[model samples]
Target: MLGELAEKGVRVTVEAEELLKSREADLELIVKLIGLQKPLISKEDVESLLKPPELRPVEVVPAAAFAPLAKEFSSDIRLNHTLDVTGKSRTRGEVENFISYFRNRYERLSRMLRRNGTVQTDLADVRKRLNERVRVVVLISDKKETKKGNLLFEVEDMTGSFKVVVSQSRYNEKILDKARGVILDDVVAITGKVLEPYIIAEEIEWPDLPVVREKSRSENDVATAYLSDIHFGSRYFLEKKLQSFVEWLHGRGEARELAGKVKYLVIAGDVVDGIGVYPNQEKELLVKDIHQQYAMFDDFIASLPDYIEVIAAPGNHDAVRRGEPQPALGKDLVSSDITLVGNPSSLSLEGVKHLVYHGTSIDSMISSIPGTAYAHPEKVMVEYLKRRHLSPIYGGNLIIPENIDYMVIDEPPDVFHCGHVHKNGYVQYRNTLVINSGTFQDRTDFQVKQGHVPTPALVPVYEMKHGRLRTLDFNY
Candidate 1:
């Protein structure tokens, strides 16, 4: 009945009518009304009425229907016209009234900006510099109360350190109570004035960063292989092939170079088969449970030598934020050998600064640059170094903090490693050796569906001696 009325250019109301009883009665009435209102009723309008709503409707008419009407109405009318109050031009008068209201509001803002010099303030260099404030999320380590009731907080980031002083006297008593409860490693955002070099925090906000368990360190020449995004819970996870790779690392025929030399192992992220990941994803999952998926990963990491240092950084598929440059898992979950670090982390490997970032964005960048993406992911990584960002854009697959500097290379790194696209590549960037370690898992359902044939590869070992580096690829 509603569809029939909609087709005949009749306004649909909530109350049911007695004239439209069944489909046959509505169809007859609709045909009659269409003939009478031929100027208003269109075939396309009837088709739209018959088709089901794209999204489920509620008690009220869906908002989607009004969007097109609103757009059309807005386009035809200007928002600064004078109103014509006469009833002879009622339709035009109503549109003019709305336009007048919009124009009045805009003019009010314009007048305020002119009177207060807000527009000029934006252009003034001194005012711009004075208003230059950066909001930072810091993990408050230590806090002390000053004589004047100001709270001094010390915070640390990957790059360097800074201090935040909050004037406790200005805040309400309840706010002070909440501020006192701040704990160690509690991620908090501080907004304040930058006094030349230091930040004088005006306000503080809280965010959650899970407490991680710590692992013991080992003294050995043991090299740990760090790789991310295996997608093991998916049908793409090659258990047999991964098993062969691990066994080869342990000491298989003709592959003994990796046995004792590989003292550490890390699976950075995407260890599970996620639900609702993409279209037809449910059909591609081999293991569905996330906990069971981690258990499998634990078993795989455990199979490595006990002396090996195993660490993991959560990926988009992992039970953490699907952001770039994620932090390694804290000490809580896995064994001591397996340490979890942030997604993009820096470590001193044999006295060489090695920065690791899972190269997920390299695909888009590679595709954009001519003859870059397919030929070498490592070369693309070097491009990121030039930009000085681990992940540049805000919300593309990887989440990054507002004030955190992922690109600041204060001290040049000797080696850089990343893995996400499952393609193995290497390149020399300035003095840094950039490596994109290929995956150990064989191609799965996603690879087949997406038509991505990955190069199944073993680890590439890098040895630094006498200020020179030697890279060796060990195939299993």
Candidate 2:
């Protein structure tokens, strides 16, 4: 019915959408609404326009299911080894290991930049050409702005370090704009004129993904539903709406037809709001016991439809290590039949590759990168793809500095799914579908202070074969 209204040039709020699905509302009113010609219909609009012939008792629907009714679900889903960090974590946090970690990251990302047909020279030998144009790949060690508003970056390769400056007056407007988004520790190729000590940058090239990669389509017509930032134990958790979503998966009203085609469900992260995550966090939590919170999560997963294969990862709020390449949720945390992987895990479903990250680094990217905010995380995600690495800024998040930089996006997944900001955003960049599934938890006091508006209970369903997307709001 929401889609029907959308076709007729009307958008409905989730609350208004819920009323339309209730016994109090009817489809005939949709025709009346179209006649009214209001582009957006809020809940109050429905209440004012909708008048029953007489007052009667309303049928109160159950808020949640007592148990998950699993059905026979058989789908082609396999976990890929390259991205999962489960038992392969190797790091001592020593200075020597940290050196190895950054060097390894540089090698991988610099190789990607070299593939762009630019002959990269080491910083030690870049000056041999003298005043000529030269290309060099280096990690940004420090950055500052000159009094004249020129951008100066102290960058270095393994061999040596040098200063590269992008003058606001001398360089093109595009180069200055791109330089504004550059953060520390970013491995990128800078092409410029070697002027004595400084390299006057003219062009900066990141290890971005190719624009023409084939977007793999599934042979089957199954769709995948994504849920994230559930925060099950939080006081702000939208239990009723989540319950409505679950019931919808089991053939509830309105968008029931699309529900049947959903073969896989991915929960990006924040399965439970962990203890002591922040100051005064305990006061906002309903279930203070952490294990009991997981118990509730286990019960919820156990209740899911059998045909919908569920794969989940941890978030900063989960009972896992707060690091970029976090391991999977411990077996002791869950007992339900589901695939448990690391924070950022890769998998293949219906022949399409999916990179599932809890998206903890989104905050860092948003703060460091210009033109990024909590509202449009898909844009920030594109920066990750452009840089060919997640968490490019080292101190942005708690990274363990493992020998291997698991944060590097070595292989581009066909679909990238993430959720941490609690705001839903979807965009397809360079044939890769990027989706931030949003959150199931409602706005909190912290979010209010941060000016973050969460699109709670708004879920996205993706069609595997056709790349079609449909969103269902369960904030009813």
Candidate 3:
């Protein structure tokens, strides 16, 4: 392997040489390593180059970020493994896999719709019973508007396909609103009857939760702090503001009382400014090495109050696979003191079920759904609940065709949490609290060009007892 590197005009340290020589070299991995455009390869470089690399801390994340916790609290974080895709990835990406994957999604969501007592007939059965109002569970394949201000779409089930249309002149805002939000590849129940060529829609129903829901609360007064998009290794990372945040966590600043009640901290993703995440991202990185980036993240997380049980998931920027349902960050990224789960992981904190996602697909939702924007990600998060499926548009985000569809929001969570757009937003929809806990990094050139104003270093704390949420502005 060292000889191969030599041919590529690359020099390797003695440790790197021993590490490479010790193992049966993987040619593809070596090729990727050389592709990094590094002049010298050290043991650290070799180690970091491996997928899900072995790592150790190299830089501190604002060494003065935190003071020691004045008081200790009991931790009560329980991960719901049933919905987590951590250890259960089993897809080979074969042609059959995609078929079975979407089939499973249709069936699961179909059953959820059935629970609403809306399954009146199958698509084939609907064709048999012409001119009859029969509800059929169908996955929308394509949609477009007509010249007469009507929404025309095609939907399909295992049995057959049907052309459906909803008239704008009908003035039914409820049905029109639902129809407007329907993107491609969404599973829904359409109550319409066949008229030889078209199915005139009467109502459209989603596999959403009950209109009335009971929000659960923790037994104790403990709270959980939500945050993400720390971008620790980026030049825009707000170090002094984060220092204030850590001080607040130690009951040293304003909202000291609230800080004392924070027994858990949930960070959805983007804990660090990952190397090579975007074009020319290197120029903005304070720490160029990926290992050092995570090292800084580790130090910052390690500096937090030990009693505050921390849970982290992966994001687009993190060193995880490039797709939704990203598996948990490995122990190499952070200390074992924290719990790591997959992106869009479900877990219980103090008896309150919280759905935590890195929310990379917010971009897709914003583009597909009208009135959804980066500044108001909570509105997009609500769409996820309404559809009861995260990343409903198959091609909108990169998805692994795993046998099981982990993106399905099988159960409406007490709290739906995500972070990706670097915007702070919180809203309670139908008893489900939705939160997009902004970023800790200041504005960047990309955001400036995109006209996005980020609410950096603003922390959201969810009070468990009353399902109340409040933000602490540490951006100063």
Candidate 4:
């Protein structure tokens, strides 16, 4: 190799030869030394020596220059380091090997930060001084009770490991006692305050709990009906029938009997005929543009009586990620009378707590579980309550948000309402009433093709009196 380098006009300095003989000359060290000795050895020459001759560097225009030579060199260094670590026997290796692995990973990550120009040395110093407060969510791996009454918890995160000590105070005792025997991998959020090199936990919280409402439920005589997934922009959208039902609400009839009673209205999801939603769907869309579709929906929602409180949530069709229990519509789209909330919002209605999730995935779940799809679609709400997830299965038809965690309601609701399959159904699970309000949209060509006929029915009314209830159907 030395004689070949000399023949190629590449000088092998005495120190470089000594380093190579000592087996301490890594690719990066060699490149750096070569560059220092001979500034004329372009990056291409170094790359050619590293690999097979067929893989030659392509010449590019000066304007379309390749990335910096230093960057390419650093990347190659990191790649070689990774390969070296991965090829070694992890079990037989000493602690030094583990340290080397970690160091390499950290250095590679640092290189990535430097490349992006996002590395802040000042911020790192500040982080060290600030005690390195890290917010980590992990499942409690194991817990040990010490003589001092402090509970030592071993926690693990995606990156690495940590520990939490809960002192034997009344508050901590209660928390630790509850945490014992928790399923391995049950996620919990822990806030760690750095105690020099180690982190001391300041607090631990359950991420699944719903936002607690501080105020007590107010006493009110007015009633509210919540429904969603109307899909108003579809050809099957029943504008005339919906108008008739609206007329019945304002006119003197069964719906009018509870006219002044209904104080609020909520539409949960799928408010529009989604763009390119299904095959041959272009012809069925009454409103093409998403913003315009929402505009039309605004007009329809506005047509309702002003006295009724309206709450609208974003559905799969709306201009948001196709996730379960999405947030309410933007303020620009709807009137002040409306309060938009997440798809699955807990509302205290006349002292009756109702948990509403626009039933998007209920059909699939129901279809999977025997007797659920045919006999009762509403019972699937009970399944969700049992699983403690709005949409437990990921990659379902609905979209879930990446960052914002879904709030879990520990306290069961008095009623649960959902609508997506466009089937009006009802069932009772323990003390909770599960209601799936049928869609306002009538049968579509898709339904006909699938040999499924949707039941066109009016909204069902419920009367709650001191935990007792009565169901009334307004089919007319």
Using lDDT as the measure, the top candidate is: 2
lDDT of 4: 0.55
| lDDT digits (tens) for residues 1-476 of candidate 3 | 66676777878889888888867757876787778787777888888776484568778655344433324446677888978888888888898879888998999999898883444677776667787777888999999988877899898998888889887865666787779888999899888767867788878888887788777898888888998999889999998888888878887877667888888889999988898887899999999887888888888877787777888888899988888778898877776578998998999887899999988889988998988888799999998998898889998989998888889998889999999999999998888989999999999999999999999988999889977789998856
Tell how far residue 204 is off in model 2, in angstroms. 0.3
Tell me how candidate 1 scores on lDDT.
Answer: 0.53
Worst 10 residues of 1 by lDDT: 77-86
Is 2 or 4 the stronger prediction by TM-score? 2
Mark the regions of model 2 whose C-alpha exceeds 4 Å error after superposition: 1-73
Candidate 1, residue 266: CA error in Å? Answer: 3.9
What TM-score, computed on C-alpha atoms, does each candidate reach? 0.50, 0.84, 0.83, 0.52
Candidate 1, residues 82-152, lDDT tens digits: the string is: 21111112222254544453233223322322332222211112223454676554445567778988767
Q: Write the per-residue lDDT of candidate 2 for residues 90-188, one digit (tens) a residue.
A: 887899879999998999999998884768889999779788999999999999989988999999998999999999874378899889989999999
| Candidate 3 global Cα RMSD | 21.3
Cα displacement (Å) at residue 98, model 4: 26
**Model 1 misplaced stretches (Cα beyond 4 Å):** 1-226, 255-258, 330-337, 464-476
TM-score attained by model 3 = 0.83
After the best TM-score superposition of candidate 2, give how far the Cα of residue 373 lies from its true spot, in angstroms: 0.8
Query: Against the hidden true structure, what lDDT does model 2 obtain?
Result: 0.86
How well does candidate 4 match the true structure in TM-score terms?
Answer: 0.52
TM-score, candidate number 2: 0.84
Among all candidates shown, the one with the greatest TM-score: 2
In lDDT terms, how accurate is model 3? 0.85
